[model samples]
Target chain A: MLTPLLLHVSILGLAAASALGLFATRRESPSMLGSARILAIVATLLVLALQLRRGMEFGGLPLVSRFDTLLMVAVLIVGAALSIDLTRGLSVLMIGALPVALAPLLFAAAIGMPDEHPERNLMHPAVGVHVFLTLGAYAVFGVAFVASILYLIEHRQLKARTGPSLLGMMPSLETSYRLTLRALAAGLVLLTAGIVLGYLYGRQVLSGASWRLDAKVWLTTVSWIFYVIVFGMSFVPAFKGRRTALASVACFVIVMATSWVASFWSHFHRYP
Target chain B: MELSVVGVNHRGAPVEVREQLSFEEARLPEALAELRRATGAAEAVILSTCNRVELYTVRAEGAAGAMESSHWLALQRGVPDSAIASVLYRHAGLDVIRHLFRVAGGLDAMVLGETQIIAQVKEAYRVAKDSGHADRVFNVLFQRALRVAKQIHTTTAIGAGGASVPAVAARLAGKVFQNLAQKRVMIVGAGETGEFTLAAFHERGTLDPLVVNRTVEHAERLIARFGGRAVGLDRLAGTLPEADVVITCLGSSEFCVTPDMVETAVRARRGEPIVFIDIAVPRNVHPGVNRIENIYLFDIDDLQGIVAQNISEREHELARCEPLIDSEARRALQELGEADVHEVVGRLRDAQHAMADEELRKTWPKLGALSPDQRQEIEYLLKRVTNKILHGPTTAIKEAARDGSTPVNFLEIVTKLFRIK
Candidate 1:
């Protein structure tokens, strides 16, 4: 319960710090920006620690339920990101990294809790492999999605020729797009492997019921298909830049919607 | 004490006037000597660059001396006193100190935080010193100015983005292609902007440059600078196929590099990344070249947009540097103030010692008649009297020094009372 309390407060603090950073950046206040960066880093770490604790409690390992696993993944990504950013001595990114770290946790909260116990027959090593790889891909996708949103916002401001804002502190357009492409490429590979493994594991475990289309299974498959199209087009000789960025944003929208519906079903119907 | 800077700059005067005021490098040493001689300047440094010519001089006596020096400098430049006098900025004491600090710190640089100005100031100081013009006061002032410049460079983000259009172009190129050393750079023109880009690319060492211009001679000149070869405009179509980076700075009415030509080049290079930088005002490269597969084209507008953004970013960070400069400025001022006080006190103490020595010489024969013990006792009593006589004046002088009141009147009274010159 205190884990949830700490997580909520830390998220709120991150939000408030980002707001302050934005305001300071707008008003061109250096001290305010410095303080905002400090607040963002500390609060992000606090929330991450709470998630790590919860992850260990749930699974003994960091992965058990999808909820625990996603929370743990988000924390690790942000922690790694901020650590890299810290070396560059750019405090401006602290505010940029916060909401990106917070999105997954907030999404997890909106989704219902995982089942306390379930049938053990579906939990084979192969199935577990499939689940973990897909989860990992989704985590990478989450990072790409966050970066894409920032890229679009920055690109718009640049196009409008507006003055300096907090958004200007983000990396250049090409860097963001490259990061998203790399993330999506890795995620797509894992997703492909995961889907194949799941299909193979399902046939072995559930026999005739393996072919019975579950909404979650179809939704995941559809999102996976969109990612394939995105991954394929990205490597096309002419389709590397603005077209690739558009595809990534589109895939993100698809991934977000499908995941939302899956969480909805899991909450209302107690479906895995 | 008074200080004055009288000169014309690129912003204030036309090239004809600025060049007239400009001190050629060969003549600078003699010019500094002449400046000191004509004005009876205690300290001076003459900063002469193509963009600006400034004479910084210090006269410890009064404003009249500084004005005389400014007049001399104007006369040397052959400009009428009334014509150039309005732009002549004069300051005494603290204002002069602040103005120099700002100039040396790059706060007053045309391109903010440009490193060239500090070196320029040092060169001017050296010339003055070589010509026996820079005295102790000017030496201290210029040394402190250089140190403040170094401090700002190391401690703040003032020099971030390198404070130049070329550096900005290099940064943007790095972000786009991620590596410049492996790329081939083709310059479509041999103008000033093209030369700047060539320098940036050469500095990054990521690309082998190829210069192509309308005239082979013009292309040859730019190519020679980078130790690269030149080609005619006819070969640009062929060279475009192999170049990883193409930069155009030809101020042409029509496009020199077209989309159809780039489209062919992209196919020829397969899917290799190509970056096009157009720094020309009239846009030398075709806008539609951006549509070519695996080819990224950014025009002058785009690069200038980035430059504008970078400038604003630096300006935002300037807010952070403002307090840093103020604190450093205050520290510098306090140090100079204290040094002035110390100098005045040292002179006063020396004058006191001279008077005491005179009095002792007169009384030594009278004291010889006393016993040895009595003689030693009398000497101690005389030393005590000397200390007692000097104590109040020394304390008042030091207090006035820190209070920044110069203590000139008090110093005069003490000298008169002690009969010490």
Candidate 2:
């Protein structure tokens, strides 16, 4: 009962904050967007705390249940975006990205909670850590995707000579371009650690589940390869700005698809 | 207390007349002393600026004529009284207060809503307070006027728009770029208007502008103030691609920045936008150059139109501010009235009550045997006695608050004699 109520409240608050942020994009007033950013952060923190408490009650992590995992992913997305906003003062960017974070929570709120989440069985601790790391990596990429969009918008305004509407609100194109690279590297490292941990746990716990036979294995590997390509290209001077922004947008989309389709089909991810 | 102003301003006098009447800072003390000696005014403040010279004074007699200030100005500056009298303007009481508010609010300035006059007023008031030329009357008046100036800008849109061409140009630049601190400017001419616009931009960020002129020496001299490099007109083409903003002002009849020049710069820039402001008389940049991709060009007339629209906006905002100023001024006058009632006399009354309360507290334990009702009756008696004793003086003070001419300082003498803490 408490989980459903908290989930609903978090969804509503996140939705309001995102809407206010959209309105504030045109306004130069910091107070207007500041209010929205604070509300979203508070909502995100409250939901994360509730989810952690639920994890402790269940004797393990919240990633055991599908609804629980989705809600926690929403919290992680908002939490990472809030941290970036605090450091860079990018309330506008937070506003742009928060709606994407809110989607999972809204979906969870509508479905409510199951009496017993079979995914909540803490059969293996290593798999729990792998799930947490992967979710965190996905959250980081969501924020990076927003920063990429900002870079593209600024680039477009400068290209079209449209007298600086979006340009005035966003950070410089160089700043956004650099942020995309930093976020991509950070996301790649976490995803790699999660995959390595997943493989180790699979060998110890699974009965004859090989990378060739499991859908989740090859999909995760493909996503990892794409990240490596992007991470390597960032070092090349010519492939720096527009190419990086495009790669960030494209890579995140592929990663999202891989997570959903691979996890749905993987027998190894289900509890025994 | 009486309020009055004797001044010569831009509206009433020519530049030559104002120059003759102006007093330097070194000569102000002697000028003030002579004016006081001649007018026999109780308190005075002299405000001097490039556009106006004014003397504000308070006299107890309430019969000070404008001729007294006029004669004093003529005698001290060694000018004929008849010559100074021709362009003199005078105000008294409420009119003087209104004039000061208007002056501080920039309604009476040569440039509508200019900020410099308020600073000048503050400086004048500071000098008067430091030199012992102003007392309580002038202090309250000038301070309230300053507050009114602040309130006018904040609560209304009177200061929401730029009233000058330079200010409009700077605002336009702010709209063009997100972070102006990182942007570089290239100035193609050394005209005064361009310099004014550059000065306005200085308030936003420190800009080391690249200045180009027909004469290399002239550009060097102008760019020295900003710690920037000076380039010759021949180098303008090469420098165009590097500059994020370009302002051109040439005295020649021919266009200096043609389509070919802009096309070359744009090709080098690839797609980065550049702002061009041509403030010259015959127009330094060709009008057709605005058709170029990634180039924004504005002529003098475009800036003037922005200025006109800005002025219209400020005028609409002024309508909103006038009522606020009127109500605020009225409230200030009422508060000043109440302050007259409180200041020294209220402090003495407080001290008297504190002394009485102490005496009663020392004897409070002795009244323990008395019933609560009996003790309350005694306390009531004490309060009535204190009120009766102060009734005459407090009534007189309240009267003085309403009528400024009433002798409010008699309570000052009472406070001093009693050695009230």
Candidate 3:
């Protein structure tokens, strides 16, 4: 009963924070933004607590369930976004981050948790590291995706010469672009390490099973290549502003597809 | 005492008339003293800016005080009374409170929601205070007006965006760069518009901007006024790579900055972002330069468009600010009124106790054979009776004040009935 109540409260908190954040951006109100930030922090902490409880119940890291994965990703996104806001005074990013963080939780709620959890080997430390690293990369890329979207909106508004209030509430174009590149760089490094560890683990566990042909593996590789290209294009002068923002947005879509949609068809990477 | 404001603002007067009535800051103290003496005002503050010349005063309650203040302002400024008679406006009591609050909050500014007027108002108050013209009533009035202005700005989006061309240019630069102070700025002309743009940048902490003009002497003159190395127009290409922001207003028909030049600068800077603000009439920078990577370009029309949009937004916020200012003015008037009522109530209570003490003293001598304990009981009884007699009127006056009734008239009635001078 207590666990369910905590889950409901966490979800409600995130939903309220997302709503308030959007309103704050539209109204350009600092006090409302402050309230949203506090709500987001409380919700993020509750989500972390839920994850810890699940890990304790599973006797290891809770990486075998889709609900667990989504919850972990949501926590990381809010945590990273909050850290940036607090440290750098970029509270405007919360306008995008809060809604993005709430999406995964809402999705998890829509698809209820599996009744009988699939039993899997959770003793391998390498697998744990790989899962955690990969999810962390996704969360960071989610922030990059948000920054890219904000950059595009602000760029369009500047080009059209409208929406002064909206423009005032957004971060600068250069700031958003710089944030995208920073997040992409950090995500790229972590993803590379996670992929390398996952490859080693795959070879050890599924030897001679043609695991390389797995749909999840192919989609993950494609997303990784897209991110690599986006990161590389940041250095090219011709693709600096709008093109780079668009590329970041497209690449994150691919990342999301790889993580959620591609997992269903993979025989070896199934999660209940 | 009653509060009054009599003046001519931009809404009521033309520049020709306003300039005639404008006060020199150096002579403000003498003018303030003269104003008080002429109008028999207990306190006064003369706020004279480019757009308005207002004399705020506190004096005996009557229409005569406002009329006298208006005539004094025009006569002191050496303008004929007939010159400003039609344009002069007067507000007394609550209207005075509302008008001052709106002025301080920038709602009455030529540019709605502009912030400079707040500083100007502050300086005016400071002058009044230093000259000993600001006393209890003006002090409370001006301080509350400043606080209301701050609250309005903080809680509303009325001051969110730039409302002028030069300001919009700086705002555009801010959008393209994270930290403007560290960025190198290049001014491609030495005209008045260029100077204004440079001043806008300097206000944001970009002090040393490169001044480039066709005439080396002109560049040097600008450099002397604002700190920066002067460069001739021939060295534009050599210095282009070092500047993160370029503001051009050379008033030339030819394109001073072309795509080729920006491409070379981009290659030299290794793809660092650069913003070109071409505020020239014939367009100083080529339109094709906007296509270059890491280059953002805006012209005069673009800056004006943003300024127009920002001004419209500020105007829309006035609806939100009006109600807030109205409520605040009402609340401030009530508080100030309650303060006066409290003083009168204290006087009334003191008078009642004094009368009771006198009566008790006279009776105690008559009862010469009374014991010490009996005398003490009689003193306590006298004090309690005095308090009970004053309590009903005090409660009625306070309740009237709190309910937003005719508090001033009610306090007057109480003061007259009790004869509590």
Q: Name the top TM-score candidate.
A: 3
Whole-model lDDT values for every prediction = 0.69, 0.75, 0.86
lDDT of 3 by residue, A135-216 (tens): 9999999999999998988877665545354357778888999999999999998899988999989888777967889888
Whole-model alpha-carbon lDDT for candidate 2: 0.75
Better of 2 and 3 by DockQ: 3
lDDT of 1 by residue, B302-369 (tens): 66666676566557667766676666656665665567656666776677666767887798897667
Provide a comma-separated list of chain B TM-scores, one per candidate. Answer: 0.84, 0.78, 0.92
Candidate maximizing lDDT: 3
Give the CA lDDT, 0 to 100, for residue B258 in model 3: 90
What digit string (tens of lDDT, one per residue) describes model 3 on residues B195-298? 89888998888858898889878887778877889888999998999899999999798999999998999988878888898999999999898877668888
Per-residue lDDT for A1-272 in model 2, tens only?
A: 67667777778889889988887776544666888898898789778877877777767777776677778788888888888788987776788779879887876776667677455335367767898898888888887888889877766654443432533357766567667777888888899999888888767766664644677777778888988898787666446566777888898888887777677788665422
lDDT value, candidate 1, whole model: 0.69
lDDT of 1 at A6: 74
TM-score of chain A of each: 0.73, 0.92, 0.95
TM-score (all chains, Cα) for each model:
0.73, 0.71, 0.91
- What DockQ, on C-alphas, does every prediction get? 0.13, 0.09, 0.44
B98-205 in candidate 2: lDDT tens per residue? 788888887777776777888999988887778788778888889988988887765555665466777766655654455677787888888888888777766677
Native contacts retained per candidate? 0.16, 0.04, 0.51
- Tens-digit per-residue lDDT, A166-185, candidate 1: 23346655566777787788
